[model samples]
Structure formats: C-alpha cells, structure tokens
Target chain A: MKHSKISNLAFTGLLAAMALVVFVLEAQLPPLTPIPGIKLGLANIFTLFALYFIGPMWALTLLIVRVTLGSVFSGQMSVFLYSMAGGLLSYLIMRLLYIRMKEDRIFVVSVFGAMAHNIGQILTGVLLMQTPALFYYLPVLLISGIITGLFTGLAAQFSIKALKKSPISDSP
Target chain B: MTGRNEHSLSALQWILIFAGLILLLLTVRFFFDLSDGNRERALILLDGKTVRTLDLSEDQTFVLDTGYGTNTIQVTDGCVSVTDADCPDRVCTAHGPLTDNSMPIICLPHHLVIRFEPGHGDVDIIAE
Candidate 1:
C-alpha cells in the first residue's frame, strides 16, 4: 500500500513542532530530583518517530529545532548547551542502532539513547563546573535514564506502530 | 530487513540487560559513597575556576561576587551552605548545609559552585 499523503517536509515540520512543544512543557515541571539532568525526556518520542518512519536526516533536524527553540521558550538559555550535548549523543546512539532495530525493538534504541543523553549531560556539567565531584551523580542519573528510557521507549514504540498504519508511514 | 530481526533483543533479554547495567552502576556508586570523607574545607568556584577556599573549622561567612551574581557562603561548625544568592531561583540557599562531601551546592544562573575539597578530611573510622 502506498502511504504517501502528507509531503515529507510538512510531516517533518509537524513532528519538529510537536517535539518543541513537549520539550518546553516538560521544562515547566519542578525538577523531579535535585540532582540535575534527570528527566523523563518525552520529547525523544518524536525524534524516534521521525527517525524510523521518516528518515535519519529528518530526525536530526527535528532534534536540533526542538532543542534550540525549547531553550528559548523555556527561558533557560544555559540549558541549550547541555541539551544539545545530550540530544546529539542520544541521537547518535539511536541512529547507529536504527538499521538493526525492528519495529518491536525501537524501545531498545530509546533506552540506549536516553542513557547516552544522561552521560553527555553529566560530562558537560563536570567540564563546565570544573568539579569532578559531579561524577557522584552518575549512578543516580544512569538509573533514572534506564527507567525513564524504558517508559519513553515504549511510548515511541507504540506511537511508531500507530504511525505505520497511517498515511505518513512511508513518507521517507 | 536482513539485519532487523537478527539484532533485536527479546523483551526479557532487554530487561535483564538493563537490570545488569543498573546493578553494575549501583555497585560503583556504593564504592564511591564510601570514598567521600566529611566536609573539612569549602571551595567556591566560578565558571569552573576556584576563587576561594574556606576552612569549616572556622565558622564564618563570606560574600562572593561572581560578576554574574553574588552567593553568600556560610560555614557554621562543620557544616557548609549558601545562605543567600542573587540568582532568581536561589536553590543553592535552599539546599541547606551539607553534612558531608557528597554533593555540592550550586547556583545555576550565576555559574557558581561551592563544594568540599576532599582528602583533608579525617577518615570515617566507623565505615572502616
């Protein structure tokens, strides 16, 4: 079945917009932990969606747009550096696994991506703060990464399944 | 398609994988936890550079001007904390005094961090 209805550009734009909205909204919540750089990362769902159903380039584009605009809208410009570091590392991990990932296995990608994201953020913190003590947060951040990644991964997996049956499934 | 199913780990396998990783990380954290001694000296850092070091043995207050903002660091007895900060959230001040060298008190907007300098502290004989 031919699944091309929405143009690729329009669909990518829509996904990018959705990712930005989620990113900014998530920032509003009081931090779940005093230990910085731990969050549910719901915005990653759209990046995963764009990558698998759309294309890698579109996924990258969606991620960049979301991080840039999300920081602006959230009124925390310092977050841009940390988010970019985490987002790029996360994207790299998932994209590397994309070819090997089956429809049922996108969650695995999300899980790994989320873990990488945390590592990237913590590393950035250590470098910026010039404090090696920040390494103490590693275990806490990694544990949060696994649990939250599983949640977001499953969410993206289910969303991908739904999109597979939609008009934009084969946009790539 | 050739590589897809070949690389996918079953749900049970992924669960075990995450479980093992979590266990491994927890163990590392446990070891790190034991390594930290009591807070003996407090150091103020701005933009990753050390600006001042205060001895906790001498209970005193120092107002730091980071150029970005100000953080009033207080050392009372063996405990240390940020009593006040010019940053909007002032979360550093709310962090209260730290009991040990576990985590640093930070002011995000001002790019300030106050933490204990390790090794100068006496060993925790109870843990040993």
Candidate 2:
C-alpha cells in the first residue's frame, strides 16, 4: 500500500506537468475570432482528464499552479486574478458534479464548468472595465463554453478510457 | 450507492435542455437584429483603458490615437470596421462589422475594443 501511494503521487505529478505543458503551448494559439474573449480552450482537455483520474484535489492544485505560472510566463500577471477566480470556480463546480452525478452524466458537469468559467471571466472584465456593457457578451461566451466544454469533455472521456488499459494504469 | 439508480436525469431531459437553449437563442436573435444606419453607441478600450466613447448616430469615422500611430475605424450601414490600423495583425480589419451584440471587434496589440450597444429604445435584456 505504501509503494502504491508513492506511485500514485508520482503519477499525479507527471499529469500535472503534462497539463502545464499543454497550457503553455495553448497560450501561443491565436483566438478563433478577434473578439477579446473567444478562444479554443484547448488546455481544458488536460484539466478534465486530471479531474477524472487524479481526482479533484489534485486537479485543483494543477489548475492553480498552471494559471499562476502561465500568467507569469506570458507577462500577463494582471490577468491572474481573473484566471484564478474562473479556474477555482470551474474546478469546484466540476468536483461537486463529478462527485454527485452519475458517471454517464459527467459531461454535464464539464459543460457547466466551462460556462461558469466564461461567466466568471466576464464578471471580472466588467469589474475591471467598470462598465456594464460587457454583460452583452455573456450570451456569446456561454454558447462558446458549451461547445468547447463538450469537445474537451469528450476528449477527456476517450483519454481516460484509453489510459485505463495502458501500462500507466498499473501505477495505482 | 448501488441501484440508487446513479443517473439523475433521463436522455429525454438532456434533449429538452438543449432544445430550450436553442429556442432562447433564436428568440434573442430575432428581436435584437440591427442593420444599416441604425443609431447606436460603442465604447473603445485600448489595453483596458477607455480611450473614447463613440456615437454611431453622428460619427461615421474617427481616427484613434494609439500613441504609436493613428488608426482609423468607420461605422457605416449599421456596422463598425477598422478601415486602417498601424498594428501588424490587421485582425481588426478582418473582424468586418459588428451586428451581433455579443461579438466585439478587438485588436489585441492596440488593446482596442469596439462592441455594439443597442439604442435606448430597444429593450434591455438584463432588465428583464
């Protein structure tokens, strides 16, 4: 049991590193549209995977570190607050739903998480800009969130299934 | 948790939720449609700074001083577009026009934002 625990921790660390790399790589991609808030949200696939395999606590740690480091490396430190708020809220919501909902219905949690992140970010934008006009963008962001979350959640599902049969699956 | 059924909602419920969302979107689009020569207002932001407030009712074109150079954006036919920019991406140009209230014309390097605001006569969605 002690050996198994060590291996699990190591595996979690590796997954965290993988998530960080994906987050960094995704930062280089341009937004799909010139809109300030539109993007592919490619890194979310890793977060969903981590949430499924390593569990919520591990996933939450990965999110915090990734956002903090990513913002620093990108020289967008000012955005750290928004990213933290969105990341934490998304992670918490995902965790609750994952714990409470049926396995087949897990994707719904992911969808809600994505929407929550967009809402959280938009709220931050409104506060920063000191304008209520930003609320108009809420609908668009929520729609984008639903689509992106579905794609990322599907990716996570497939990845988890594949990983279960791989050599790494024996770690725990 | 065994045989507690595990599942909360049936497949039918999921379908209903998606259908409802679609219906809401269509209704919003139908009511909020904006076209040529409509009077509106837009707020311009450069790197989080509110540089200017534009009135679409009167101003057809204006030059924004980006501290680097002057960039020109024009509002015509109930749409806003970047006619000229010193920025390298020229993304603002590609954004074309703003018809949707949710979509904004953004130039990241310049931190410029151009988003549509419905006229005062139009109903505010938030108020409802």
Candidate 3:
C-alpha cells in the first residue's frame, strides 16, 4: 500500500508538470481568435486523462498545481484568478460527469467541463469589470468552447487509450 | 460497463444535442441582435466610468490615455474601432471594428471597453 501511494504521488507530480508545460507552450502561440475567452485549451487534455486514469483527488491536485505554476511562469498575476475560477469549475463538472458515466464517455465530460470553464471565466470578468457588456461574448464563447473542447477531449481519449497499452499503465 | 445500461443516451447523442442547442441559441441571438438597428453612438469606459462618447457617423481619430496605457480609437463610416493600443494583448485593437452591439472590444489590462450604446437618444445608459 505504501509503495502504491508513493507511485501515485510521483505520477501526479509528473502529470502536473506535463500540464504546466502544455499550458505555457500553448500560451506562447498567437491567439486563435481575437476573442479573449477562446483558445485551444490543450493543457486540459492532461487533466482529463489524469481524472480518468489516476482518480479525482489526484486529478484535482494536478489541476490546481498546474494552473498556479503556469500563471507564475507566465508573469501575469491578474490572470491567476481567472485561471483558478475556470480550472476549479471545469474540474467539478468533470468529476460530476465521471461519477455518473462510463470511462468511454470522457469526451462528453470534457465538453461540459470546457463549457463550465468558459462560464466561470466570463463570470469572473463580469465581476471584475462590473459590467454586463461581457455577456455579449457569451454566444461566441459557447461555440468556441464546444469546438475546442471536442479537440482536447478527443486528444485526451486517444492518449488514454495509448497509455493503457503501455507497461506503466499498471502503476495507476 | 453495467452503469451504461442505466443511461438512455450515448455520448455521441449528448454531443449532438448540445451542439444543436448552442447553434440554435446562436441563431436566435444573431437575429435579435440584427433587429436592434445601427447604433449611432459608441461609449468608451475606463474603470467602469464613461471616459468618452463618440458619434459613429463622424470620421475621426483620437487617443485615450487611461493612466494604465493608451488606446487610439478611430471612427469611420458608422463604425468604431481601436486602431492601436499599448496593452499587452492588443485584443481590443485587433478586434477590427464595431458595427453592432453583439460584442464589445475590451482591454482587460487597462480596464477599458468600447461598446456601442443602443437606441437613438441623448440619455446614455451606463452599463453596470
């Protein structure tokens, strides 16, 4: 039991690091759309995989660590609040979906997770700016979230399947 | 796998349902937004306060200094846009122009927003 616990912690740390790397790398790319809330959200792929294979607790920890570290690395303290709001909401939605659905339906979990993330960020924006004008972007954000979510979700699903065939799959 | 039997719809079905719902919502919003008519005035707010209001029918260019940074706004042929900005993202500047009230160009770093004031009237409604 102790050995498994140690492996679990190590694996969680690895996933967090991978997620942070992906987050920062994706940030370096030019914005896909001029709209603020839209992006590829590639880092979510790691969180989705960890949530499915590792467990909810580890997945949540990895998400928190990755968002915090990614913000620090990006040198944008203001963005940290937005990331926290979006990341936590996304994690919660994915957790709720995971409990009710089969593992094969991870992509569905990811879609709703992405939508929840966008809603959380927009809410944060409304609060910070003290304006309702942000809601004008909601429809566009919803469409973007669905498209990006599908991409990230499919990527996560294939990655999970590939990892299942590897020897280290037994560790988690 | 036993849990799967309890759910009537598959994942693909759920995705389709959501996609269709969102598309329908978008279509409805687009049509409603179009019926609002062309906005003749644009309001520039800094820190949730009205800093400037421009008549969209006029062709003019001006710079707004919001203490945090500067943004150059241009009004041409019933359209308004941020031609340039010193903010890190330049998202507002890149937003091109606002011919409709569908979306406001926002610069988070400077807490500046350019939005069209709907309805033709001298009474300006400050969005809260």
Candidate 4:
C-alpha cells in the first residue's frame, strides 16, 4: 500500500514535469500572428488528462506545480501572481464543471476551460496593471481560447485512447 | 443517458454563450457612437525598445523600420492597423485595423508591441 501511494505521487510529479516541458516548448514556438493573444496552450493537454484519468486533486496539484515551475524557468517571476490567479481560477472552473456537468465530451470541457483560463488571465492582467482597459481584449481572447481548446481536446482524446490500449494498466 | 443529456446541454450552453458574445460585439460595433469620443492610444516598441506612441484616431500614419524592412501603421476613426509590412507572415497586416480595448498591433520579428492605453493617464501595469 505504501509503495502504491509512493508510485502515485511519483507519477503525479512526472506528469507535472511533462507539463512544464510542454509549456516551454510552446513558448519557444514562433508565436502565431494575425491574432495577437493566441497561443498553442500545449500544457493544457496534461491538465485535462490528469483531470479525467487520475483525479481532480492530482490535476490541481500538477497544475500548480507546473505553473510555478514554468514561471521560474521562464524567468518571468513578475507575472507569477497573474499566472497564479489564472491557474487557480482555471482549476476551480474545471473542477466545478467536471463535477456539476456530466459531459464526457472533452471538446466542450476544453473550450470551457480555455475560455475560463483567458478570463482569469485577463482579470489578473487588469488587477496587476490597475487598468480596466485590459478588458477590451477579453472578447478576442475568448475566441482564441475556443480554437486552442478544441485542438488540445482532440489531442487529449487520442492520448486517452492510447493509454487505455496499453497493456501496462491491465489490472481490472 | 445522463451523460448524453449533459453533453447535449453543455454544447447548447456554449453555443448560447458564444451567441450572446456575438450580440454584444455587434452592439458595441454599431451602436455605441464612438465618433466623437476620446481616442485611445498605444505605445509601439521595436527591437526590445520603445519606439513611438501611436494615436488611434484614424488621422495619423506611422512608419516603422523593422530590421528586415519597413511597416506602416495607419490609425483612423478610433481604429488602428498595420497598413503595410515586410514580414513574410504578413500576419500583422492580416490582423487589419484593431479597435478592441486592450490588444495591440504586434510584429514579432521586429519585437514590436502595440497595446491600448486608457486616457486617464493611469500607470500601474507594464506590458510583458
């Protein structure tokens, strides 16, 4: 039993590390233009996978760890507070929706999560900057969220299928 | 059955939300009467440096010298846009004129950022 718990913890840590790698990789990509606020949001796949497969608390832990480590690695400690605000809100929203709404549709969840994430981030930006002008970009960001969320959702669905097929988890 | 019902409802909910957003957007686009209001402005930075302040009043055009070439920004009637650019992506130009509140005209290769500023002269946040 103790070994099982230790392995779970280790797995969670590994997932968080994987998330950080995704974040860094996404950051390194040439930012898409035409839409100023758009991003690949690569780390969200891990978060969603953890949410459904492992559990909400583990997902939350992975999210917090990933965000913190990603911030540290990026050397943008100044935006740490904003990212925290965004991350917390996103985690809560995903939890609420997952519990209250019974949708196995990862696509919808991804869209909702992405939208909520943008709102949280923009709100944090407003709070940090002390400028309501930041609200003006909310709509654009919302639209971008839907697009990226759909992409990540599809990726998660495939990953989940692949994981299910793996013989390593044959313990019924 | 419960899962199916919930999935359908959630889809409908998202659609309604997006519809409401579009309605709000159309209203803001057509009815607000921004013709005579105060024009917002943004600072354009290039090459990791501040280059100039741009007025989004449809009355000014500014040319920027990106390392690779040149780009032109035109502002008119409460909107700002990249009229021309030399980047291969031309994404900045494709963004067309920007009238939204917080976003700016950005050209990444040039390391340029354009974001809106409130007229009240508040300075609490710096762009990241």
Candidate with maximal DockQ: 3
Using TM-score, give the best candidate's number: 3
Docking class of 3: medium
Which residue pairs collide, candidate 3? none
Off by over 4 Å in 1: A1-6, A166-172, B1-3, B57-63, B83-96, B120-128
User: What does the TM-score come to for chain B in model 3?
Assistant: 0.78
Tell me model 4's lDDT, rounded to 2 decimals: 0.67
lDDT of 1 by residue, B2-67 (tens): 454875667889889999999998897777666565467777778767788878898888788888
Instruction: List, residue by residue over A82-150, the lDDT tens digit for candidate 4.
Output: 567777887787787777644246667777788788888777655544444445556677777877887
A103, model 2: CA deviation in Å?
3.6
Report the Cα lDDT for residue B9, model 1. 63
Query: What range of 10 consecutive residues in model 3 chain A has the weakest lDDT sum?
Result: A1-10
lDDT of 2 by residue, A1-172 (tens): 1236566567667766777677767666654666555566666777777777766766777788778877777665656777787788888788888876544555677778888888888787776655555565676677777777767777787788777779867644
DockQ of each: 0.42, 0.29, 0.50, 0.20
| Candidate 2 segments exceeding 4 Å error | A1-6, B1-5, B10-16, B34-79, B83-94, B106-112, B115-118, B123-128
Residue A22 of model 2 has an lDDT of 74
Which candidate would rank higher by TM-score, 1 or 3?
A: 3
The fraction of reference interface contacts (C-alpha pairs within 8 A across chains A and B) present in each candidate is 0.44, 0.19, 0.41, 0.24
Q: How close is candidate 3 to the true structure, as a TM-score?
A: 0.90
Q: What is the TM-score of chain B alone in each candidate?
A: 0.71, 0.56, 0.78, 0.56
Interface RMSD, all candidates in order, equals 3.4, 4.2, 2.3, 6.6
| Top-down DockQ ranking | 3, 1, 2, 4
